[model samples]
Target: MVRKLLFVATLSVASGFKVDQAPVKTALLQLRGGADATQIAKYVAYSTSAFMFIPAGRDVFSPGAEIMPDDDKLLGKMFTDKSKEGYMFMWNQWGVNWIMLSIMKILAVSSGSADFLKLGFATDVVTFAMMFKGWIPEFKPFVVMFGLELLALGKLAFA
Candidate 1:
């Protein structure tokens, strides 16, 4: 009985330290040649953000948009149906920021640098804070956007 118990213990200990012959693949390993998860996630995040301009046109981009809760909204009534200037201001603001981020992501991917992902991570943090703080109203599309940002953040962090 004692011999059998000792043999079992030894086998368990040996198996615990057993190393697989196969190379352990990771995101870092994928970084060498082809597109890694980080690059894909970054591209997805930026591209999705850029395309948001289309869907948002009904709200912030148009004059007399229906989404404005109040005329004196912080974003400015002029940007809403209250005035032409306010609408233009909000529209340009969205376009510029979204487009710039997308361009940065493209540059980062093509250059094979993780530097630009840092910006994306930071932006995600701020956006999340805004959402949680109620500065930005919660909506179904925003939830989806938040999930994409989270995915990018995870890849950025691990990579």
Candidate 2:
């Protein structure tokens, strides 16, 4: 039975129905040894900043206050005012986020490490919290993005 199972496993891997773990483990070991910690730090910073910028842009442009339920309270008005920032602020935030994401991608490619992938997972978690905090039901795009990010994180974390 053991021999039969081994043969099946080998055949499955050879046919690409199963991933061969040896090469992946070897690559991960090499990456752990060779990857620069500073580069990984930079990648994480950029990635996290990029993730934050999306909601920041939305806050400045669309301003969730528009869809917020009507309230005569001063606190509600204050929150609304804070959400509606100037156009320049929103544009600059978006531009900076894009630049950071670009830098992070470059660093990730150069480092050839899985650390960046982990950082991406962290970014998604943080961004998801930010989205949930904002409580904006109108932004369906954010929901879709969160779902996709979670899927990617699961794949990277598990595989």
Candidate 3:
């Protein structure tokens, strides 16, 4: 019982801090063919911060202790953010950050340092908005299928 509890606790902490696109990590770690260590460290620090804000306040996840009122408010806020007006504003803020990180990831991957996948995660947001505002007229799932961003397992339909 104690071992199982410990495993669960470890998993939670690991999952909480796990950011996507690890290729960025490898590129900066190239000591032999890399630039000054201090410079790389600074860059990494900035990139780490950029990642946190990339998803537009994705760090605003609810804590385990806030299982009641806080969780309810958070659900409500997510709904509000999904609304047409809120979605656009939030997406703009998040989209800018995502584009910056994507550029960095692309540089790192194409330079033979890190071979991480291109993390073009924000294209989905724009795609969703298009579908909602009657831009993409289709009855399918509209999966991007590029960066493992969307997964439509079952059948999808718009009514």
Candidate 4:
């Protein structure tokens, strides 16, 4: 099962190169109202990760929810519960990371700077390491985030 998952991830990453094609790029650009293809792809990856976690929001927002079972729940509470320090950590610090990365990616592509892309890739690596090193309370979000990150990494690698 793990091998199958790895293979799928590899395939998805490899397929990111397809976005570079003229037809696909044109369609994506039109779909995004003239946004860069690579940027669109990267945002799709981030959006996919966010969407995957949406289902778990119910558990975190439940009226009786208190102690969290794992990092996912804790992370969710960090968003819904403003009284906790984790809320600030999640919104002010952790959540800002993605926005910053997105800006870095845009600058990297726009300036044709390999350095920025390298930095973005490095940040993604560290983020993945931190996420995976922790215990996984749920399988769906983990797998979805991992897969989408792989796709993003693939595009970043080529960009």
If scored against the real structure, what TM-score would every candidate get?
A: 0.52, 0.40, 0.23, 0.43
For model 2, the local distance difference test gives: 0.54
Q: Which of the two, 1 or 2, has more lDDT? A: 1
Best model number under TM-score: 1
Relative to the true structure, candidate 2 reaches a TM of 0.40
lDDT per residue for candidate 3 within 31-149, as digits (tens), equals 54655444443354335334434233442332122333244444353444454665655545554665565565445433423222223223434555665665332313232222122
Name the candidate that leads on lDDT: 1
Cα displacement (angstroms), candidate 1, residue 64, comes to 5.8
The digit string of per-residue lDDT tens for model 4 on 118-147 reads 676676666667767764555345555655
Model 1: residues >4 Å from true position, as ranges? 1-43, 56-79, 135-138
Q: What would you estimate as the lDDT of candidate 3?
A: 0.41
lDDT preference between candidates 2 and 3, better one: 2
lDDT of 2 at 145: 52
- Residue 61 displacement in candidate 2 (angstroms): 13
Q: How many backbone clashes does candidate 4 have?
A: 0
RMSD of 2: 15.2
Look at candidate 3 and tell me the lDDT of residue 124.
Answer: 39
